[model samples]
Target: MAEGRSVSDMDVDDVIAMFPKIDPFLIRKWHYAFYTFFDLIGNNVIEWKDFQSLIDAIGAVRGEGSEDHVAAKVSLTKVWKSMTDTMKKDVEDEVKSTSSWKLHVHSSKPCDNRKTEKVLF
Candidate 1:
């Protein structure tokens, strides 16, 4: 498991496995949250950075320390490394491309695209 590797290649099951004590259903819900959040930038996958942030937030809420963070990172990284090279590249490219694109909303009159071409990224 590489420290700098992304976790986008890992599936929902692998990601949820990091939190052994948590309910898998709850983790799936969080995955959906990440999915919806990334949808804003045209990304359907949850990259390692996004998952790490979510994990960090949860750890903070639960008063978790560095040990938990380390363990989560290691678990996720192991899954990430198990992914194929092509999948890894695809995930990396998606993250870079989506993150680079900006969401620009233009509304001149009503809430319609007729007034202005809404470029929602």
Candidate 2:
């Protein structure tokens, strides 16, 4: 995490293992940080893969059923819902401009509710 920490001088697992020996609280903190980072990267990667597969399938749209359309639309919604308001509009704009994947556009408008809005992303 330090500036100019050479990759060759580091082994992430080794630093992570040092947590328990250093402090129990430090271990927990390390775990929380790592898990959050891991989950973020994992989710991004998964969604990217999902979009890639969906795009690959788009070429065979002749075999696509109504459910396929619904699923694609829902995927768009799920992805957009995961972003912030500023990014949400950017995504929606991109979706509108991308002619090839117009079939996957979602209708869910990001809302600014008075309650129950938590920062999931």
Best by lDDT: 1
As a TM-score, model 1 comes out at: 0.33
Worst 10 residues of 2 by lDDT: 97-106
Q: Per-residue lDDT of 1-121 in model 2, one digit per residue for the tens?
A: 4235442353444444433244444434433432342223333222334444554465358345556655765764565445324234444333221111111111133343211123222
The C-alpha lDDT values of all candidates are 0.44, 0.36
Q: Candidate 2: RMSD over Cα atoms?
A: 12.4
lDDT, candidate 1, equals 0.44
Clashes of each: 0, 0
Off by over 4 Å in 1: 1-42, 84-91, 95-121
Specify the poorest-scoring 10-residue window by lDDT in model 1: 98-107
Q: Write the per-residue lDDT of candidate 1 for residues 7-82, one digit (tens) a residue.
A: 5565667655555565777556555544564333334543556656756765787657677766766765543333
